[model samples]
Target: MSARFVQQLPHRRERVADWFARPGAVTRLTPGAAPLTPRAAAADLAAGETVFAMPVGLSWRARHDPAAFIPGRRFADEVVNAPWRALTGWRHVHELADSRGPGGAGTVVVDRIRARVPAAALHGLFAFRHTTLAGDLAAADRLAGVLGIGAGVGREPGERLPRLTIAVTGASGTVGTALVALLGTAGHEVIRLVRGAAAGPGERRWDPEAPAADLLEGVDALVHLAGAPIAGRFTEAHLAAVRDSRVGPTRRLAEAVAAAGTPVVVSASAVGYYGADRGGEILDEDAAAGPRTEALAGIVADWEDAWAPARAAGARVALLRTGLVLAGGGGLLPPLAGLTRACLGGRLGSGRQWFPWIALDDLVDLYHRAALDPALAGPVNAVAPGGVDNAAFTRTLAEVLRRPVGPPVPAAGPALLLGRRGAAELALADQPAVPARLVSMGHVFRHPGLAGALRHELLRPAPERG
Candidate 1:
């Protein structure tokens, strides 16, 4: 027995080939999987071409032996995972239509997948997501616009499923609130893990310091975002507060997970673990954690290590090294907003050090990506790929807000007032984490660069009265 699905697209025969022939063109979408970016299989396109792919849980190679082509009409590709299993196979079929309607413009699609799963269970698994067959077709549309092969962007239809239950600590915090919205939009049941009495509907409170395992029962995943603010002065006691806020709760949660045997666990870490090294080395996932880091870095190190119990108990662990977020509501945004409104905003310190950061929207995307991605079970930097330095960041931001950059704020002044901790974060410290793991896994970034990201996340257009 076979399943047949057809997508009707109105595009020129030449348009179909053009879309596939271009760079960054992804031919098909697989359900519960990322899009498959197909470059030409030829020299041009030759026989027996091997392409690299990191799909979902595995980073593997797919060797394509083009079996057929119809010039401007359609083409065929037979692919399989080489050196892994003879079982995995895929045939991608692309077709075009006449551009008679919609102003003589049209749609070219590369989709229609047929796979022969090696085993019965494998077949059933793929068969389940075979329902989400539109992704490949949709990527064909996006690939068209990216290379100017097509004028407009294409979007795949949305999927509606029952929400995946999610438990969040610090649901009242800015990032947590954003996470709720993001996860909620992605159809997840959000349960807030509050401290004491947030005692509302859909909330669970637990005291990590008390060491009772009530919170560990029946929850799928855990995101510990509750920690003392890294703002104000970093006194010895303040440092202890930051340490206790993260480490104590994290340790307790991990112990509970180990005892209860709950499966998925994700906790937050920081790029600060890399420490403040001004050397222009773009760190990747393989980069070892350097020893001589700062106090904040030490705290991050401890927080991540505290998850050992959960890891030992067989729960997948994710340590999110989140970057400075540029959002509207809370965080570093409020002060920047105030400055933008006053037109006195300027770059901090020397402004040459890089600031690896993500937009609030992108950060939310990271949470979703992190949760669904099972293979990602270690430290992953959640910063933008094309991160900007402080100086360029300020200028672009000012340009976006239609404001002017004033005289640069120096480190000494902030140290005198905001103290050493504030100075280190705001003025001196800089990191450019490349999000290497994400790119390798084929996660498309909506805001790749700084200016565009700020425009999308922060510099929203004023609302019209009409």
Candidate 2:
């Protein structure tokens, strides 16, 4: 089969092509909803080949056609080895051209592909690619504007922003992975702070308990994201693991940042700081923390306080009080998506509890902004503006998947699995949080509404025309 897709992106042709040629462009453009995971690839398309791990332990390898690589015009790649290559051949060509329509000063992206994959299957993939490209370009532009840099929207010839060297912990985690790629593609240098010995020029050894005083030397900013997963039974051991991983380590890192005099710090926090059961109350950054009795509430309070040393040293610190992050590849979405696909999706508990959530991309963008924008300080509520109830979220997911909702999952079900408090604080939390600070700062969410966000991350295709 052969297909061609074109989109008029509101960006200069050179800028769009430059984005595609950047280090993390492939990682950024790969569809999250796809089953295949990228195993290894060249830093940039011009470098060489890309490999993806497929199901059943198979691999898909594609080589970039160097002869066809035109710096700001076109590039092509072909699948040389894959489980399905014997059945069909595959080649894709990407072209960027100046928009021709009257008053149109943007780039027109053209994608042409030939493969045995069905047109119906290819449609959604390409549609997702185009949409992702557009969103990423917009995000880059916004970041430039936020930082008072050039190279976005309106720019003079050869004008660009100077890149910063950012240090990040938890670089392999979902959020960190996305944020690193976003930063790399946007022309910033990212240093992954590994717990073990440094791996490459892009990494540094970090002992969380007692980080070296010079660990953050020459780093423009630091994003702290290392913490234990909090999705298990809320036993004493599990709770201790979560708290111990965060509170002490965060303080140690904060001290290191203070000593190093890193100008900015963005640390991970949680919405649970406000108590899991603040029903109907719209909490913002200014709201008081929940009582210390609640496990997460207390832990989060301590976690944010850990940044005191850095803040006291005059470093601008922003605590990310994140909500449930929605994405196809990881986080809360995968299991729910699986159950929903199996016709087992339903509301948890009372169904009236507010679900404060944010798209994975939006969360990454917020981190990007927080790292650069000196004006962004203190606690920032990282969530979508449109908070939905559990029932509404269930309905939207089912509607997007075109599946019927199964029977409601009783409160007892989660309690049995995660224990009563775990279920209560996590699965059944009712905090109606909003991004009041983000809104006040004129932050723009790429996906604000739950339905639209779900559709984009889930790769829901456009409606068919009869």
Candidate 3:
């Protein structure tokens, strides 16, 4: 079977080509639901062989046809070896051309594939690819504008922003992985700070408890995402792990940044700083910390304060008071999505506690901005604007998945699993947080509504034609 998909991308042909040529482009384009996992880096996309790990211990190796590669115009790849190579064939060609017309000022992307898979079965994949491409390009454009690079300058469209060398902790985490890929595709150098010895190129050893003095040396910016996860039964050990990980390590990293005189530092924080059970109150970055009695609230407050060293040294620091992050690959969404799909999803407890949330991509973008945009400083609530209550969230998620709502989960359900205090502070917590700082800075959210955000992450059918 043969299939062709075309998309009018609002980016110059050269820009689109540059994105494809970048190291993390393939990763960004691949959907979370896709079975194939990219085993090759961006440098291996041309001429070099690329391998993909498939389910059931299968693998597919393909080679880019260097002879047919036309820079900034076209490229093609074909399966050189695979488990089904004898039973089926696979080849794909990517073509780019400048759009023509009175107001046309973009590129037309054409994807042609020859494979045994039916076009209908492949629609979701291509749709996801195009959506991701458009979003990435748009984000790059916005970043360029914010940084005052590209356009109006002599730089080519492909060079939207000056390349940056950013060092990131928690590089293997969900948010970190997405942020690193986004940065890599934007033509930035990413140095992952690993706990152990440096693994490969672009990785460096970092001791969170006592970071090396030169850890931030030569690094343009530092994104500190390392912290023990807060989700659990809220046992004494769990609480200690969460607090100890952030306060001490963050202070240590802040000192290192100050020592190295790193100009930019973006650290992870949480909206829980506002305390739990603040019903109906719209909290922004300016809101005071919730009473110290709240476990998470106290931990988050210390977490944000740990950056004092860096701030004192005059480095621009951003504390992201993040909310519930929604993504299909991991985090809060996957398990919730599974429950919703199984018709076991419903409102929790009173169903009236406010739930502040943000799309994973939006959170990544906020981090990217905080790292690059010097104007963004201090606490920034990283969440979608309109906050929803537990009941609303449950209904919206159910609607998105086209599943009926199951019976409401009684308050005791979470209390039994998380203990009374844990349930009250976590599963039953409420903080109607908003991104006032981001909004004031004219930040654009790709998915502002819960339905749309859920749809995008879950790879649901889109209204736009593919």
Judging by TM-score against the true structure, name the best candidate: 2
Alpha carbon deviation, residue 13, candidate 3 (Å): 0.9
RMSD of each: 18.8, 2.0, 2.2
lDDT of 1 by residue, 1-466 (tens): 1234444454444444543453223222221112332222343332455454455655344444455656666665656555344554566555555555664645544445566633332332233222112233343344333333434343222222223577888777767766665464344667888888756656877786875667756777777788887766767788788888988888888898888787777677778777666477787766656454467778888888999999998988888888887765567766775686578788888888888888765676666556655777888888888888888878877887778886788768778855776577545776667789888877666567877666544434323369
Error in Å for residue 413 of model 2: 1.0
TM-score of each: 0.65, 0.95, 0.94
Candidate 2 residue-wise lDDT, 419-446, digit = tens = 9999989999899888999999889999
Which scores higher on lDDT, 2 or 3?
Answer: 2
**By lDDT: ranked, best first:** 2, 3, 1
Off by over 4 Å in 1: 1-162, 290-293, 462-466
Per-model CA lDDT versus the true structure: 0.63, 0.86, 0.85
Task: Kindly provide the TM-score of model 3 when superposed on the true structure, using C-alpha atoms.
Answer: 0.94
Can you give the lDDT of residue 12 in candidate 2?
Answer: 75
Error of 1 at 439 (Å): 1.0
Residue pairs in clash, model 2: none
Please identify which of the two predictions, 2 or 3, would achieve the higher TM-score against the true structure.
2
